[model samples]
Target: MNPVAVSIEDRVLALITEDELVSLTEALVAAGGENPGGTEEATVAVLEAFCLGAGLETLAEEAAPGRPNLTAVLRGGDRPGLLFLGHSDVVPAGEGWDRPPFEPYVRDGRLFGRGATDMKGGLAAVAVALKALKAAGVDLPGDITLACTVDEEDLGIGIRAYTRAHLGERFSGCVVAEPTDLGTVVGCRGDSYIDVTVHGRSAHSGRPADGLNAIDAAARIIALVREDHERLQQDQDALLGAGSWNVGLIEGGTGTSMVAGECRLSLDRRLMPDDNAARILESLRERIAEAGLERDGFAVSAAVTMEMPGFRTPEDHPLVADAVAALSDCGVASGIGGWTAACDGGFIARDFGVPTIVMGPGGLNDQAHQVNESVSIAELVAAARAYALLCLRHSSPA
Candidate 1:
């Protein structure tokens, strides 16, 4: 490692102060008001407010009427840039909590709130690290881009639009600040959402035999999918493991005394490198055919609603080596591993073809999306140091 690079890393770690981290967290929790996924207008408003307060240039892209995604840039020297990606939206705060969902609370050295562990904590930590680096007069050799987008908990329209309209060929690498238990995540499984609809005739329940039931056809289709899931496990790929399928939602008959006229099943499929949307649709069609549901009376149609492909950076990639060395300087010992859950890293890696990694504070099973979701301050501080070190190691002049 270069001496100057090591020195920069050490300085960044030292500069990540406790007050800075606390302020960032406070701003995040204050801004991340009530509302989850689809209803994140207030949250976006708070994020924009925080950005303006920090004197950072804020750019908002309207994904919908009131829903907007935010992007802010922390200027640095001329070099290859790094993007810090995070999502402002979080899952719904279900029942059972000591405090309200929107009201941020700190207790027992941990921050308790809805978005604390799943993502907001990580985002706050990144903000604090950048603030410290700027204050310390350490001119980064590269730029730091911070993007906190909406619709990550439901649909990723924010990232999709951003990548399509902007950032087409700008960034060098990206780090999705998702909760990875302070571990480095190098790759993730691909994901696709499909809606399968089966059509049949409707008749009076008294004469059920007079009409073909779409519900029964849907049942057959579900069975075929279960079998397909097993086969997918057998044909698992090396990096992504087994391609799995889950029937998320099913809708059928309307009236209690009527035979079902239509049935629609929503499927969530985790794909491997070898699997694509078209191939998965074809497989579903083949399964329907094998189940003898290809006739006119029983028709099956598939529509792909969303897709995010899996991605991996080679172990020898420069970005990977740099990240590992930075973590080692922070006294962390570990190698990168695959993540079971998907994030915007898929978009960065697959769409932009950028070397992306998912790394941050908090554990994987800290009751994310639960009533009492929380993140330890120690973990938050450690993550801030790690991210600061990462910037130093990657941005120092050679």
Candidate 2:
């Protein structure tokens, strides 16, 4: 495939207007695709309708009931395609906001809403970028696919199921439009949810010495886990820094007068690309054993509830280079970076065997689920331009 002898950048920029981008983002923010009780159906409809109006082929498939993953494709070049991926779901809008969480509003040049900075804004930018490319009338070297998945905040069934269905498809590269504040994220830490249960005997308050206290055993386990967390800090990755763990929740003890029978602990552990949940759990169990928790009356068991793998793309990868160049073209000064929090890109990179980068508008490490989560309008426009340029630069055949 011969390269089209035209500068596709200017054409793409010209077609991606600020007004439409803001309007699209505002509408999406208003849709409230908050997870927990999903409403991705409505958000998917909005994105699919926008894609259809832009003369792109659109598909909406539910990862689960009412949780739809939306995809749009613009066939341009015949080379291996590029996928622009993002999530339609946002974390539930909790409390303490200047305005209503779902009521989209703009003030001081920032779009304030629940999904504004986290991803919905980025999703809109990618959609408009594709529309701009289509409107530019430039021949692309390969196809461009824009996918908005559901349930990214929770279990990530959206991307997992989508990848399971499209595993045979090949892409030269993928860019997850996760909020990077216009920077490119080359790697991220993975996450795991773990449960630790400590079992013991219950007895009356007067006979406390006769029965072992599960909460006491749990406290010992927590101390050992904290030691494990500190120990992991010594094994750090250059990009992701270091692995860490936190005991997020703990529950036990039925009454103040009786000895606690059982204790349950929920933990969140961050992993490097090379780490796995099984190994981490094994390490925790070892720690428990070292703490002398496995005895006649006291026993501890650890189970992994969820595990998401992490990934890192080398700086020389074509996908990363092209993204950096595109950001440069957009007059955005960006360098390769890493994300402390995991994202759906990890799934794409791990399962699909595609080099994936996290890049988008908004703050580099912006607070997404917090009260008054907002994104800069100017940054979003820049992100749109950057996405358009990246598609032309990376997806086109040399």
TM-score of each: 0.92, 0.94
What lDDT tens digits, residue by residue, belong to model 2 across residues 1-398?
A: 23343455665688999899999999898888888777788888888888999989988888998788888999875687899889998888988988899899989999999999889899999999999988887687788999888888887789888898888877888898988888889998999899999899899988999888999999998888788888888977778988898999999989999999899999999889888999889978887887787755697778998788898999888888888888887788998989888988888888888898999887645457778999999989989988888877775333
Residue pairs in candidate 1 whose N, alpha carbon or C atoms collide under 3 angstroms: none
Off by over 4 Å in 2: 1-7, 364-366, 395-398
Worst 10 residues of 1 by lDDT: 30-39
- Give a tens-digit lDDT track for model 1, residues 1-398: 78886676676678777666766665576566344436666666766665566556678888766777788776777776788898887787778878876677778988887888878888888877776676666776777778877777776787887787675546668888888877778888878899999888899999999878999999998898898888878875555577799999999987889999899999999876446877888878887887788674788899899887777777677777777776676667746887766787788777777788888877666556777888878878878887777776664323
Shift of residue 329 alpha carbon in model 1, Å: 2.6
Clash pairs of candidate 2? Answer: 77-140, 77-141, 77-142, 181-362
Listed per candidate, the RMSD to the true structure in angstroms reads 2.4, 2.2
> Which one wins on lDDT?
2
